[model samples]
Structures are given as structure tokens and as C-alpha cells.
Target: MGDGKSSPNPSSDGEEEVRREMPAKKKVVVVMGATGAGKSKLAIDLASYLPCPIEIVNADSMQVYQGLDVLTNKVPLSERQGVPHHLLGTVAASEEFTSKDFRDLAIAIIDDILARDRVPVIVGGTNYYIQALVSPFLVDDVVDDITACSLNSSRELKSVDSCAGYERLKEIDPVAANRIHPNDHRKINRYLSLYESSGVPPSSLFQGEAAKKWGRADCLRYDCCFIWVDAALPVLDRFVDQRVDCMIAGGLLNEVHEIYKPNADYTRGLRQAIGVREFEEFFRYYFSNTMADGTCVCGNCSAYNSEDGTPSSINEYEEALEPNFLEILNSNDNNLKVLLCESIDKLKANTRKLVRRQKRRLNQLKKYFGWDLHNVDATEALLSMPCCLL
Candidate 1:
């Protein structure tokens, strides 16, 4: 929509008139990059440079949930500098927030901001969310009755094994089947459902020229200015390590403990966050070995409350547990210590992996979708600026 080329005029005399008459597309700035690359900071900083008021719409999948402020690295209100942020920590921790949901809400919020004469800055490392916001089509959107179709497909395939499902998908839509892993039963089932419901092969949806450039600039919903806040891998890796340590010290354990449950589902919602599942083994062992009757078994532990069995406050409860927690951490039991240390190391390692993955996906988007990303190097800032700012 913002291709920067003027429309051809029928006559030379009417060229100026046609140029003046054409309406300008609304501008939306999208700041994206790897995690810990300072996308949020850059989005906030754009407020001072852009002439109009700016509101940020978070596109990060994890940061959209209600908890794990430290784990998700959500910018604190004090650091937001009074800039309004939408869809940040607005979803229930247990609820699944999908790309469709994000696109629907972000479009509404962006429209509202544009109507108010303020620019909407989309910021996050989740490129899929940004892609959904800008692009009109989604793979799932092709089905008119996806829920009903999925139910019927599930019933029909209830008795089928994974191997059988793959064979069936290959028979009906070999192109789609070849694209995905044989182990990806969810995607296989989805393809089966789409074909069964619409009487069309799933592969047909992606066959046309229009589908080839699904998320390219020519097919965008808004005139988007994409900014990639980038940094050297070494710098990002070191920063991520320090950031994980800072998150741990900033009560990450307490947060994880609050949400920890035995045999909890870590495949969905906030539980899918990097820090949450990484400590599952540690917490399972910690609670079983150290906790008894809602109090630590360690002699150094104090009663949560003498008057009532319950804690006075959440803060006081956490404070009482902290010392006992530390004692267990320092305990002679090598197993517990190993689990705790391994979880921390895993958190850092996973975060670094996420950084690399996000960077790769960003490049893929630029290469495949023709995203004109303005790269802003942040290595200097990462070195000099406080980790909290990033």
C-alpha cells in the first residue's frame, strides 16, 4: 500500500490533481528483533522522535499473559515513560492466546490509536503475531467452520494411528504432507480437517501467486515501517545470561513457585514461558523434600503466622520461605543443588537459543516476505546501558 510509486494519470494536466487527491495510508511502526535486543525500549524511544503521540501494542506471545513480569521481560510502568501500552499482560495466565486473537485485538487497538491521531508502535520478538497483524490471510482462516470440521475430523480419525493419519494425509494432500514432519500429528489432523470440510485439497490454498507473497509489503493492511533492533550475537548472548541472573534475583523463583503444580501442563499458556517449565524438576523436588504442612521442614524455617495458620501477606509468606529456600539451596544434598543449578543453566541456555531462533526468523521474514526492515544496531547500547533498560 505504501509502495512510494505514484499512480499513472490519463493526461499530464491532471497528474498533479490525481496526486493531491490520493489519500495517504495510515502509518504504523513495527519494532521487532531477537529477544533482549531492546525492541520495547526502541518503541518507547520513538515517541520522542516521532511528531505525534505514540502508543505501543505488544506482539510478544509470552508478555501478553497476566503474570511473569520478570520472566517475560515486560517493560515496567516506570520505564514506559507514560506511553500507553495495549495488550500487555491483559490475558489470563491459563488462557491460550493465539495469533488470530492477537491480530484481531491489535487491529482494533491500532485503529483506535490512529483515530485519536496517535501512532501505534507494534513491538515484540514474536514475528508471527506481527505477520498476522499486517497480512490478511492465515492458514486456519481458510476454513469457514474450523471448529465443526475439527470435531468431525477428530471423531473420524479417533481410531487411526499416527502412521495411518500420515498415509491418509499423503493420499489426499501429498504436497501439504511433504511440507510437515510425520510426527506433527496436530498439523496433519488440521490438513485432514481442511480437506474434509471444504472438499478442497489443503495444498490448493497455497498454490496461487497471491499466496506466494502472503505477508509481503504489497499485501499489507497498513503502511508499516519495520525496525529491527539488532545486536552482535556475542553481546546478545552475554546480555541474556546477565538478564537471566537478574530475573532470578528479582523474585523469579517466587513467581514460579506460586504457579507451580504437580504434573502441570507446560504446553500451553503462561506455563510455556521459558523460565516456568525449566524449573519444573527443581520445584517438584523442592516441594516434596523441603515443604511439610505448608511450612519448610528445615529448623531455620519460621511459622508463616503464629496467630493463624495462613500467611499475613503474600510478601511476608515469600519472605519467610526465602531463608528456608536458601538453606535448601545451600544444603549438603547434591541432588537438590544440581537440579536447581541445572534449571538456572537451562533457562539461560534456552533464552540464548530463543535469541538465535528469533533472529533467524526475522531474517526469513525479510527474505521471503520482502520486509524492508531498517536495522538499528544496539550492541553499543547493550554494552553501556543498564540491563533493566533492555
Candidate 2:
């Protein structure tokens, strides 16, 4: 929805003048938490009662891509009410929208909101995008391998000898090598390239740039208020289960089929969404195991293929199959039930993992910008006005 411009009335000339002279503080509200933690709902609720108009800027990476609204857990139109939302489902599913892209777009949108005298509410679970917007992406943070190379083409950077490269980096840029895990060949390559292109080490570049910028490595690029909406793990787990069930009922599998293609670009873009990849295996198995009319052809029908095409014969995948896997597959109703249950469990597990990672990111954010953070229990916050100051 487009933002509604508030026109001034001559009758309220005094109030308008005061507002124009002393505009509201230009700060953005960042509601961050795990999936199914009700971050979006909290933003809508807060905006509903705020004295000033508020606009929601989407920060969830998946929601930016067009389609898969149900899978991405986008707020339904009926629920959004009349509040204007920006950056949700604005990009095509085929395209990739990175955190850098989000940072640029969001900054511009936030500026417009401030110009319109409306508060910008940034809400989502994608911690990286929010982090990018809040902090500056220093040039030293990203070491270009090509720029690091002295020659026209450095084949060593692209060599399969990853171990030798790690050793080489340790000899040249010991600080960079120590910061990077020995097993991480990609980072090793980047450090090696930086050394080859320039005699200086990555540590020196970072320290030099950091000293020039804010006397430290990290600095806030935007003044923001971080609201961490948190809930108990058990409560969140139940919510995750219910959300997965709802997505299934909402035809999430059909939505998956719409964009599901063999050898598709699953590593990038909307296809990387958890639901899309997790369900791809089940959908493929379901289609192949069943007939054109949905008749079961396999006896137990318990065996299923994973994303890697490895067959698992039980509720969980194991190197050794159960002795009665064949017998179980032959079972009538129980076989189908088990397969469906396993698929659902996989979805729940993946979602839970995502939430755990997001929660951990909170600690990092708190450490980086602790003074700016104000966390609240989501359940308690929902009952009362979370941000009365806004």
C-alpha cells in the first residue's frame, strides 16, 4: 500500500508550525527475532496505536522475492490493514537480492519515510540484512581476490590445491590466516590473493581503515532502535510446528511446484528459502512413489530419497536400514502416515535450526550495539504498548 500524505490545515497552523520546526527524531524501529516469534505481528500492533503514521520496511530476505508468500510467512493483506508496507515481494523470484541491495533500497525508503514525517519500522528475521543497514560495509571487510593478484591472471587463487594455499596464507598473512579457519579454503584463497596483489596484510588494511573511520573496526552507519522480540524455546517450537502445518494446508507444496525445477539455482535467490528446498525432496519422492491417480505402488512406501538422492528407510536417515524396512513399506495406511510425518519433521527441524542461528546472532548484535538494543518478551510486549515513546 502507498503512504498517505498528511496535509496541513490552516486551522491547526500553530501545531503544524511546531511540528515542522521540531520534527520527530529520525530513527528506525528494528524488530528482530527468530521465525514464528511474531515480529511482524508486533510491528503491526505497535503501528496500530502509535500517534504518528508508521511504515513497515521488509527486511526478511525471502519475503523480498515475489510469490511464496505463504511459505515466507508474509503477513496476509487482511491482517496488514491499511498500514503501508515497503519492499515486500518487490523482486522477481528468479533474481537474487543480497543484503547490500537491501541496505541501499532500505536507506532510500527510510529517507522518504522521514521526509513524509512517518516512522520507519524495519521488521524481519534476516539478521544479516539488518546488520548491513545498521553498520557500514567497510572496504577492508571484503578482500577482492582479483585486486590482490599482481599479475594479469593468478591461477593459484583458483587452484584445487586448497591446503597448500592455506599454508601459503599462513606464511604471508598470518593474522588473516589465524582469523580464518584452516578448513575454510575460500577465505584462505581471499587472503592469499590480497597478499599477492599488495605487499601489505589484511590485518594492516583493516586496522588502518578502522582507525580512519571511527577509531575501531565497527561503527553504526544509521541511528536505530533495536527491539528484540523473544520467546521461550518450547513455545517457539510449538509455534514452528503449527506454522508448518498451516503452510501445508495453505498449499505450500503446490507453491513449491510452481517454482521447482530440476537443477534449479537453489543456492541463490528465493529458491534458497527453507521451505522450498526442504520440501523439494518430499515432493519429488511423493510424485515418483505415487501413480498418476495417487495410488501407492510401493509396498511399505516408507523408503524416501533425500535431496542428494540417498534412500532412507526409516523415520530418520541412517547408514544401516532397519531389518523390517521392506515389511514396513508394504503396510497400508501406516506407510503413508510415516512418510508424511517424516517430511513434516524435517521441515520443523530445519526451521528450528534457522531460529537457533538467528537467536545466536542476537548475542553478536547485542555485543556490537548493546546500548542501542531494547529487548522485550514478545508475549508481554503484545499485551501492552511495546514502544510508547514512538
Candidate 3:
């Protein structure tokens, strides 16, 4: 469905002046929480009662993938309670989604709503994503080869080469060691790499830029509303149990079994969603074992098991436009394309501004953008973003 909104009416002081037209104002409400956090249920509830027509903006990392809704724990339309929603199940499972893409899409849809005058209610708790939707990327830590080697191999750290790197890191960026998990050889190696190459500690580089970047809202030049959902731990845990049960009921086991293969790329985009990975492991190594010996422990299985996610994959890619712009650019109808392109560009830009505005409030809390947060850049070498963002 689309945004249903009316144009805004802005009045100016009477000075015998000609009246300029007013534009529709965009407003958003975001529902955030971890899995099983009742985000969808709450969003639909708000949409039903609010004076403004409510549209849901999906912030879940996995639900954007077209057909994998079952394992991702997506709320069905029957479950949406008649509110018009956008951007859920919009992308094909085979495609890659970046937070940048989601940020752009959310902006566009919100603009469409504002043009008509409706409220956009963003839902779901892809935590980092909730931040990224509102803020720019920050690079904090230095990642290097030694960290990679150490994290990869569970080898002795006192080895001469590893110790040398450790000492070097201690001297240049001691705080980095303090911050990262001591057992996390990957991070240690990265800090050492930064120390080796830059001769400066990772801590020094991202101090301001590292975090606390969200300044005051309203002050940032926008009229907006922010709502945060804090579900209790016990309640959230129960919700998770129910959600996992639902996934199993929805054929998540078969889904995992289908993807369980040596040739299968479990690391592929939507396939790496949380439950997908767990069950994939359950199937490949654990399933046959369950049938053969009936247990989860495999002392002899190969060591590809990792709890880290398919962050790179589990996002919505850019959606295609009406193609009129391309046709115009091709001189096949140039005038129409230019007009549409300009219009779409403005909408997307305004949406991005609003998203950035929202990120500031969420960032200030520090729970969502906590010191415990990990930087995406340090994890990967590419220009990429989380689906929601932190």
C-alpha cells in the first residue's frame, strides 16, 4: 500500500504579501525491540487508533527478503489489522540489502505519505538498523590481519608473533584491548593492524566520530516525533520462545534442511537470518545426527559453525523505478524522465534528512547505540550498511 496524506498548510504574517504554497509535513513513529519484542503487534495497534492514517515501515533485517517471511518471523497481512504497510516482503530473497538501501526506501515511502499527509510508523528491532536509519556511519576500531588470524585460529596468544602484535597494540591503542573481548582474537588483531599501519590507536580516531554523534533533535531543522519501545527481559524471552515456536510451525525446519548442504551457500543474503542459520546448522550437522544418534553435540563435525550473522546479505536492495526516467535519459522520452527523476530525488533526499533526524534521538540513549556497539566498517572492507543501523 502507499502513504495516504494531505498537503501541509503553512501560514505567514500578513504584510500584504503574496502567499507561497505549503507542502505536506512527514511524521514518523518507530517501534523498536529485539526479536519477539511485539513490534509488529504494537505498530498495527497504533495505526488503528491514531488520527493520522498509519503506514508501517519495516526495519527488520530479514523480512525484506521476498519469500523467507516464515523463518524471519514476519507479521502476516491478516495480522497487520488493516493498516497500510510498506517495504515488507518487497525484495526477492536472492538480492542483497544494505541499510543505505533501506534508509533510502523508508524516506521515499514516508515522502509519499507526507505528500498525501499520513504518518509513517517504522517497526521492528534490528537494533543497529534503528540507529543507521537515523545517523551516518561511524568508524571506531582499527582491524588488521593479526586480529583475523587470532580470531580465526584458537591458537596460543603467547606465541612470539602474536605477542609482538599484542605489545604493539598495548603501546599504541591500549584502550582498544580493554574494549574488545579478550577472547576475540579477531578484534585484537585488528587493533594491532591499526597500530602497525597508522601508528595511532583505534581509540583516538573515532572519539567524537566514533559515537555520541547524535546532536539535539528539533534543533536539527525538522518537525518530528520519536517513540521508543522497551520490552522487559522476561517478557521478551517469552516472546522469543513463542516466535521460535511459530517459525517451527511455519516449516522452518524444512527450510533449514533445504539449505543444508556443502554446496549451498548458507552465507547467502536472506538465508543467513538468525533462525535460518541455527536451523541450517541443526540440519546439516545436527539433523542426520539426530536421526542417526539423536543428539546436538558433534565432537567430530567440521568447524564452520559461527554465531555471527549474514549482516552483508540480510537487507533490502534498491527497488526499481517506473523506468520512465531511464527511457527519458535514453532520449526516448527525455522530458518526462527529467521531471520524474527530479521529483523522486527530492523525495528521497527529504526522507534521508528525516531519517538522520530520527537517528539522533535513538543514538543519545546509548542502549541502542551503546559503547557495546560494534562498527560495521571495522567488520568489513566495503562501503556497506546494516539493514536498520546502530
Score candidate 1 by lDDT. 0.80
- How big is the positional error of residue 241 in model 3, measured in Å on the Cα after superposition? 1.7
Clashing pairs in 2: 148-197, 299-329, 299-330, 300-329, 300-330
lDDT of 1 by residue, 1-390 (tens): 578766576486487687689777679999999999889988999999999999999999889999989889899999999999999999999897777789999999999999999999999988778888998776557544454545454444444566688899999888767544454455566677666655678777666864865687877888999999999999999999988888877778778887887787665688878899889899877655544345564454463554444545655434654434445567887887889899999999988998887888788789877899999999999999878778
By lDDT, highest first, what's the ranking? Answer: 1, 2, 3
Off by over 4 Å in 3: 1-26, 136-224, 263-268, 285-390
Of the candidates numbered 1 and 2, which has the greater TM-score value?
Answer: 1
Which residue window of length 10 is worst by lDDT in model 2? Answer: 317-326
Candidate 3 lDDT, tens digit per residue, 1-390?
247654354333332243334433345666654444345766787866789887788887678777666666677777677888787888877676655567778777777877777887778655444444655442321233333444343333343343466566667777655443232233456455545554556776445644445322322112345555444444433334544445544555445444445345444467655555343332344333322432223223222223421112222111111111123234533443454344334433433332333334345444533322221111121113222111
The order of the candidates by TM-score, greatest first, is: 1, 2, 3
TM-score for all predictions?
0.79, 0.67, 0.52
Worst 10 residues of 3 by lDDT: 316-325
Tens digits of lDDT, candidate 2, 119-173: 8999998876786677665333455533544563354555446568777887877
Model 2 bad stretches (over 4 Å): 1-25, 138-208, 211-218, 290-337, 379-390
lDDT of each: 0.80, 0.67, 0.49
Instruction: Identify the runs in model 1 with alpha carbons over 4 angstroms from their true place.
Output: 1-23, 144-204, 209-213, 291-329
State the number of backbone clashes in model 1.
Answer: 0
- Rate residue 31 of model 1 by lDDT: 95
